[model samples]
Target: MQDYSEKVQVIHNEKFGRHLVAQLDIEAGDTLVEERPLLVAPHWECGQMKCAKCLQESYVMCRSCKMFPLCMDCQGHDDFECQFFASGGPGGYICKDLLVKNYGVCALMKFLLLLEDPSTRKDCERLLETPINLDDYRDGDGMWQEHEELAVRPLMASGLLMSLTQAQSLTADDLHAYCIRIDSYSFEVTARDGDTLKGVFVCGSLPHHCVPNTVVALDEEFNLKLYAAVDLKSGEVIYNSYTNPLMGTSQRQHQLRLTRRLECSCSRCLDPTECGTNMSSVKCRECPDGYALCELSSGGDWRCSKCSAILPAADVHELLAELGGALVEAKGELQAFESLLAQYKTLLHPNHFLMLDIKQNIASILRATALMNCMDQPSKKLLARRVELCSELLPICRAVVPGISKLYAIALFEYLLSLIELVELQFSEGELNKKEYATHLKTGRLVAKEAMDLLRFEPENSSEGYLVERLAMELERIESDIAKYGR
Candidate 1:
């Protein structure tokens, strides 16, 4: 096995076949690994015009082929006769044109192209030859059987194999084995332009967890950096959440089986209340208080911990569907959003997924208002309320997503901006005391700095990148004002 770094080592076990474990004590926010993507593709169904090579916005097409879009720098590179292009001098063939429109086909094509390199091809073959324990994916459980017949068989027959290999052919069994490799080790690549693509990282061999201890960040070039979400002890297993961190336990498990093709027995998945976050809980109709805790078992009832109020599984699903519809229609309308919030206030816990959805929607409105520079009475009130809402959400975000996650970073930026504006508004009206103003200024500086710390890893031209620059300028202006004025 190829060693990624001194901080982590590869290990194999019966439950999770191959995973990474910490070698030394690591601090929170410490970088554990940095791996480049083995393959990258345009965002799935992304209709935006982009450079085929660099993935940046480009209007320039290859003059000879008129088929492939190229950024100026990539077009100017002298190695036009490289492996990516056909042998012709100027009108060389573009290899990527073989796969387009579909993200899965495109990504797979890129992976095959990567294997054309002798060194990478050898590494991939060796990695696939290593045996993995499949006791978790047995035939009797309906997991392995369904996956083989449905997913694996269809992919092998899809003609992607014949196209990429350039005349080389592989059997269904060969493709099936490769599918296992891809599903087990692939990373979801997020580009600098906010496009999401499936990527295979050269050193992305991490274990699975419903609540991961580490988080991954990527740059414009798709180079990945892993950061410790919490302080790590030596020899502890490092885990990555393959699914969204905010997903309820049951929802996460279902999604995981479809993607990772394994049943999760992680600590959070086994817990009824998801480690006391109550993310999957719903308020009992019979009981005035106490939430009905959901279980993974089909026969298991959402039994109220406090009372004997039983919620039928079907009813919970119905409520969730209704909540999704309401949230979708509540966009950009404060009254509709507030009504839904009021309705769900009693139907779900404060930290439940529904409530979080409403809070996030409200935050979006506040962000728009802040950007509009609207300081009318109602807008100022909204801004103050937003500051409180964000303050509440930030601690919860830190508790669950304890690293430099994009959501946490964005929330921090919005919160700092709101605070900065609120303080300025108060000062303009001469209603701010010097001490209080200074405190707000100091808090803004600290939060903005933290947000920037995370945003520095993002692409410069991306939305996060623009936010970082704006926040930095605001922070600098705040400091200058503080220096010029007393207190």
Candidate 2:
């Protein structure tokens, strides 16, 4: 494995409960480092046998799809439950690699390299065919602890392990000694057998800042690395692009409630400072000669902060038009589309027609980012949320747009993926309902059909559009199976 000087440290701070910091001044386009695999497990019918989530009896489910095993008894326990809301069905892919052999942290770091990205081309073009694990290699729990004494397996097994220096720099300890996050940042690729990696897409690497110092993109080396778009002094916290550190208590609280698991009381979160400008909402059109409009107060009449005059609600329509046009054109603004959303609130209520339009744009960006980032391969909550978002948007899409828009189509397609997850979840929970499973499978097929139609115009819908397009074939296959076997 390539060795470079990387930094890791643990520290304590009030802003972040318990934090970790890593100081590696990655040259302009250098790839961010990878992490040491905490543990390695056997894959398939090798030495060990169990599910990734439930740790129950695991068997090779499918050699082609590479997913979960069908379990009528334990659907709720697996990590990536099928997306269907129904209980049990053979329609979902089963788990084959419980221990993630032949894959490890290298794969994790590689997948995470894509984050907050927009295009699916960047994702699909990459070669990620999995490897087979050697039967002779099997390590028990002590194997993970052996990392301190052994160099990671051949670079060929995975790739360069992430520098441990980075991990130490980014964390701190309390009296209890358990690692609480100084900031939420860490890679999620667990080590599989042969020291291979399973579960790509690193998570928990960024500390929070109001304005991010870095943007998400793949590095020149084809590894996912954090970049410093702007300069920063030592001791300043690093951050990712998509958030408003400055907002009101209620607003920040709500977002945190949904995204992060904490309720924030940070300075920028509660009180408006910086430029004495309102952030929680868009400025109203009361009176600012040159300043843009936004929500002036937490509540009440709308007006501009720069000039204290009142903005009439009627003119908001014009502002909405401007906001929509700018939002559509901002090719490089994936992380800060909120800036685009600000103008619309001046005219419409939180859920007004124009405001909904802005939300649709925001969701579209988020969906694209999620796929390129390989979110489903990692975070459980993110996968579930992605499933939920697609489900929520479907009805709205059918009613609002005549046919599904590109985003809507992608959302629908993603929802079908979600149904598969639902099946996985239900099956793992041991509550698989064949009837419900069939229902969800059917629903997913319908939605997949709609999304395929939309892809004609909006190809940027999801990362797996082509995979979803192939759903029709899978559906026909499933129908034939049902007819032949009488399931």
Write the residue-wise lDDT of candidate 2 on 342-440 in tens digits.
644444434333444455555565556655755444344544555655565555444322322343555566567656665656545655666665665
Best by lDDT: 1
TM-score for all models, in order of appearance: 0.79, 0.31
Where model 1 places Cα greater than 4 Å from the true spot, the runs are: 1-3, 44-52, 57-69, 76-85, 88-104, 126-167, 172-196, 295-298, 403-407, 449-471, 481-486
Tell me the tens digit of each residue's lDDT in model 1 across 30-101: 777777665555533344545556666566765554434567767532122133443432233233343333
lDDT of 2 at 192: 17
Q: Locate the minimum summed-lDDT window of 10 residues in model 1.
A: 77-86
lDDT of each: 0.68, 0.39
lDDT of 1 at 21: 85
TM-score of 2: 0.31
